[model samples]
Every structure is written in C-alpha cells, then in structure tokens.
Target: MVAPPDNDVLRASALHFQHHDGSPALQGVSLGVREGEVLAVTGPRGSGKTSLLRCLAGLDRPQRGEVWFDGVAVHTLGALARARLRRHRFGWIDPVPVLVPELTVWENAALPLMLRGTGRRRARRAALEWLERLDVDGRARSRPHELRHSERQRVCIARALTVVPSVLFADEPTAPLHRAESAQVLRTLTAAARSHGVTVVLACAGPRRAGLADRTVTLLDGRRVRTLHLPPVAGPAGPAEGAEPAGSAGTEGRPACSLSA
Candidate 1:
C-alpha cells in the first residue's frame, strides 16, 4: 500500500472497487493531491479513472483501502456525514453539465449556496461573480436549455467555483465541448483554482488535456502505471512549455511505457 503523503489535501491508498456485477473496477490504486495543486488522472476508457475519482470524492466507497481528505478518513463516514461533507467542502463537475431546467444560469450556479441556507440575494451575488469570471455572466438570465453545451459547462464551472470548496473533482468536465472551447474553459478553470488556492483533481482521457495539471497519474486496467511531474509555470491551465519529461514505473512487475513529451 502507498502511504498518504504529508500535507496532502486528498489521498487514496490501495483503493479497490468492484462494479455492481462484481467486476473489478479498481485494483490497489493509490495517489495524493496536494493543497492548491492540480492533479490529473488520465487513462483510456474502462481504465478505472471515473471509479477512482468517485471513491476519492466520497461519492462512492471503495470495497477495500482508504481515502483521506485533509486528514479525515472518508471511508468511515456515514451516508449523511458523507453527504454533508460533499455539500460543504468538496465541489464536482461531471462530463455532462446537469442543470435545473427551470433555473436561470446564475440561479443554477448559486444552487449550492442556496441549499446551504445562504440568502438568495447573497448567493446570486456570489454566483454572478463566478459567472463573470468564467465569461458566462452575459447569459446569467438564460435557462439551462436555452444555453449551448459549452455555455452550460462554463456555468457548471461557475457553480462549482461559487463556494470555492477546498477541493474540486472534475471528471472530464470539458468532454462535450470542441477543442477550442475545451481549452478556453480549462484555462479559466485552472486560473480560478490557482487564484483561490483550491485543490483540483481532474480526470481525463488524454495527455493533452492532462497536461494542464501540475502532475499526472496514468492508470491502466485499474492500476497506476506511471506518474508525470511538470515544472511550474505562470498558468496552471493548458500545456506546460519546456516541461521535464515524465517518469514511469511498472505495475505488477509489467513493463511501463514512457510518458515523456
């Protein structure tokens, strides 16, 4: 088992999970994400990236192993406790932006704060600020169905940022957008996270997208196969320029391929 790293905001140790039909989805996966840093989990389809993300975010529990967030053992929390933690501390952006059909863009962005009992006006103000930052404020009065897919994704990002949660789990958040739109949204998201010191764990399918992060962890068939560490640069989003080559290691004694740029 890999031990959680010191000063890590989130850590997963030897996580093992199974699908509803008892098919193994994750096998002894371990990783750590530091506070205020972005870590991208990248892999091909059916490689367990989503499962690992869900387990780390407390949305699902691993059948074996441990998940820790800021020193708290997430696996031990009850359903209500886990729900409360998710509500108050963590933020999530899924592959698809799921929004309330009746709510306006700003209203949808402010939903989390409203659910937590913040006054509607205050929530709206905060939500608008994030929307503006994400370049979606012009559409604040529009309903979800009225916005384009890319715009909706931006609004979803605004919603996640409204609370400025300690950590954000984004699972292929830009998958529905075109290349240019994806890059734009990623730039905004990473800049916002850096400015606010929000830790981020982004799961994606390709290295090009994963390059936006400070580090990348690659998974193959439910196990970590390699780790890439990129040098610090001005922007936290987009590809790193002149980045050091990535390091690799075998999984279960199998030969690992290089992730070098």
Candidate 2:
C-alpha cells in the first residue's frame, strides 16, 4: 500500500466511484490536503465535487482507491467506525439545513457535541459562540420551524463549526443565501477554520465562491483538471459583444497539487 505523506492531513489516490445505476461520479481522482489548509473543489454541476467530498469525509467509500486521514486508512474502516470518526473528528454542512423540529436552534447546533458526551452547559456555550459568529445567536431559543430558510442555513453553519472538527466538509454551504450574506458567512467560516487550525474541503458549483480557499482544485466529469473555463454569464439581451462566450476548457489532473500559502 502507498503511504500517505507525513504532512498531509487528508489524501486520496486513484479514487473511483459509481452510482447504483452504473453512473460514474468519480474517475481516478486524486488529491491531498495539508493540515489546517482550506481546499476548494470547484466545478460545474455533475463534476463530482460533492462525490469527492463524500468519499474524503467517509460519508461514502470509493469503490476503488484509498483514503488516508492523519496516517489512518479511512477507506478500510467499517461503517460504524467511520461514523464514530466523523462524530468526533469531522464536521459537515450541506446545501440545505436540517434540524430537529422538537429542538431549539441552540440545541440543534449543540447536538453533535452533546452526543459526544460533552456537558450540556458546555456544549450550549460552544454552540452559542458559533451562532453569534454566524449571526444566528438571537434565534438560539427558536425552534427550527420558527426560523427562515436563510436563518436555518446560518444555524447549520454554526452547528458544523461548533465542534471545531479537525476536518470540515462543506458542500454548497451558502447555496441558500444571497450574495452579500454568502460572502460574510464564508469569511466567518474560513476565518474560524484558520484560527482553529481546522482543515476544510469546500465543494462549490463554480470558482466564483472559492476565492477564500488557500488553493482550489477543479473537477470535470469526475476527473481533476488544471483549469475550468466557465462560460460567461448571459445578460437579458444575450451574450455581450466582448463576452468570453459560453463553453469550458480544462486539462487532466497534474501531479503534486498542493495548497500553497
């Protein structure tokens, strides 16, 4: 077996995955994330960004290839083991917010830490801190149903950061927010991760929202690429005279892709 690098917090090699109906999601993709680094995986829809995040986060195992985390072989771990690892060491934020209806916002944010045996009071304290950071602390006592969709997403982002997990997998985390709110929230998330020494693997539909990452890796049809030229946005009258035009271009993956400072 090929060993992971000593400095890499997460690494994947020759990853291959397919859906139940034989649709491909990842194809021989490989990459590495250094400790405390924020890496953005950018691509258009159906480019395997989310699939790669799932495999690296242990939410799904690749049919072929290896995943290593801090020198441990994550791909070889059983489902139960993976669950435990995720609960204690990893955080995740989805595009949508999901919270327990019966629980208050703070309770939902604190759920993971509480599940890990943290004292209720301590967990609440931690949860409240993150909520405030995400600008959702005022709704701490409100149940999930009481909050707006954007508010709920903020709470979810707070929840994911409360534990300060070693690695956080965020898939389109700001999809529900407006552009202004998205920018503010992303700044908070990335700033917090850097301060806490947390590694982040952020998946996005395009590069527009990936500027906060230390480095970015683009994916195309489940494969890594050197560049992904997105088509210009179409205005009401159609493409502007000097618009770059609608299309994309990319190259196959390169070697030793690193997150440079």
Candidate 3:
C-alpha cells in the first residue's frame, strides 16, 4: 500500500544465511523495496528465495551483512526487539494457507487485531470489513475445515492482511489457486498495499501475474543478479486486515556484494 510515500521501509545488504554445517542457503544478496512498490524475488526451488525473505523479515538472521528497516539494522537487534518489529512493523505470510480448523472465518481474520489489544467487537467488525473487501463475507461463519481449498486460501490471506502493516512479505502466495484465483489474490494483495501505502515484497518462483510487480529481482544460483521495474497495474484495494507498520526506507540499492562472487 502506497500511503503518501513511505518515510521508512526496508533495504538488505550483502545478506547471507547458512545452515548448521555452514553450507549456504542464501549468499550475499542486496536489494531495496519501497513503499507502494511490490518486488518479486524469484528463482528455482531451493534457490534461497524463502531464506532471503526470512532474513528480510528478521525471522531468520544472516551470517553476514544486514537488513535495514526504517533505518534500523535488523541484524543488530535482540531477539525480542526483532519480534516486536515483526508484530508492529512487518507481516510475513507463507505461500500455503495456515488457518485454524476450529476457528470461524471471522475469528481467523480478527486474530491479529485482537492480539494487538483491539476489543473483540472492534476486531470482528474490522474482520467483516476485510471479508467484504475480499468478497468473502458470505464465508464469515465458516470454519477453515468447512471451506473449499481456494476459500481456505483466501481466509488465510484475509488474516494476513487484517493487521494493516507497513510492509507485507509473502512467500509463494498463490501456489494452490487455479490460474484465475491466483490472479485474483494477487490483485487483492496489490490493491491492499497501494490503498494503504504498504509495501508488498514477495518471494516468487518466477510466475507473477502479468502486471503485479513494481520491481523484480532475479536470484540466480543463490545470488541476486539483476533488478528492474514493472509498470503500475491495478489490484484489489485491501483485505481489511493489518500487516505491519512502515519503518525504514532506502534509496535504490547497489550491486549485491558477495564473498563467493
């Protein structure tokens, strides 16, 4: 979502992540994603696409380099600080839908806000708005177990967007949907970002719908190779969910620095 241009967002520099054996998962990646922009990070499976996003979201830390959000270096933060930042400033949704089988659709959508201290009534009201925004209000009383695969996917998505964060980082995002449903979800996410001025950065395996990206970074052999911009295209306004607050912003990035390169 591009709300008046973000004052702070995120940037990554010479980032790398390693397994216990010291074999690399992601190596020396660097990039920037701005507010109101969507950057697709794509590559083959096992190419560190997920790991790279984890580093950006502070869910996984890199062994080398830094991830800066709103000018704060994530690599330097304590674990608790990073967690708070994630809750308040960043939203990360995995490619697959993760919904509680027993929770009603409204409960799933309202969880984030309720956790953030909003009253149940207020949260559910917000949840209804999101469901309506996504055209899923009719499913509000349905449990995840009661939904069709695609509807469950949207419920998961509605939950993710409910908190209205500054930046939304998602992985896969559309692997389960048919081509048309996948396209629809992409537009919903994109519109939510643009409408709220949130920045949406996603990890892709190279199949973004024809016009969802504001930029694309190709990761080849575990390293970033190039970056470019896509023309603006329209999408859904928002999912009535909250993501995270906006934080760091950086100018465009430099060539990815790498020890192995």
Give the number of the best model, judged by TM-score.
Answer: 2
Residues 100-215, model 3: lDDT tens digits:
77889999999988888899999999888878877788999988888887787777777778888878888888877898888888888888878888888887775445258887
lDDT of 3: 0.75
> Which of 1 and 3 is ahead in lDDT?
1
Please provide TM-scores, in order, for all candidate models, with all chains considered together. 0.85, 0.89, 0.81
Tens-place lDDT digits, model 2, residues 152-194: 9999999999999999999999999999999999999999999
What's the candidate order when arranged by decreasing TM-score? 2, 1, 3
Summed over model 3, clashes come to 28
Higher lDDT: candidate 1 or 2? 2
Candidate 2 lDDT for residue 89 = 95
C-alpha lDDT score of every prediction, in listed order: 0.86, 0.89, 0.75
* Top lDDT model: 2
lDDT of 1 by residue, 1-261 (tens): 333558888988889999889989898998888899999888767879999989998999999999999878998889898999999999999999899999899999999999988999999999999999888999999999999988898899999999999999999999989998898889889989999999999999888887789998887678786543322334567436654333222223222343422
Compared with the true structure, model 1 gives a TM-score of: 0.85
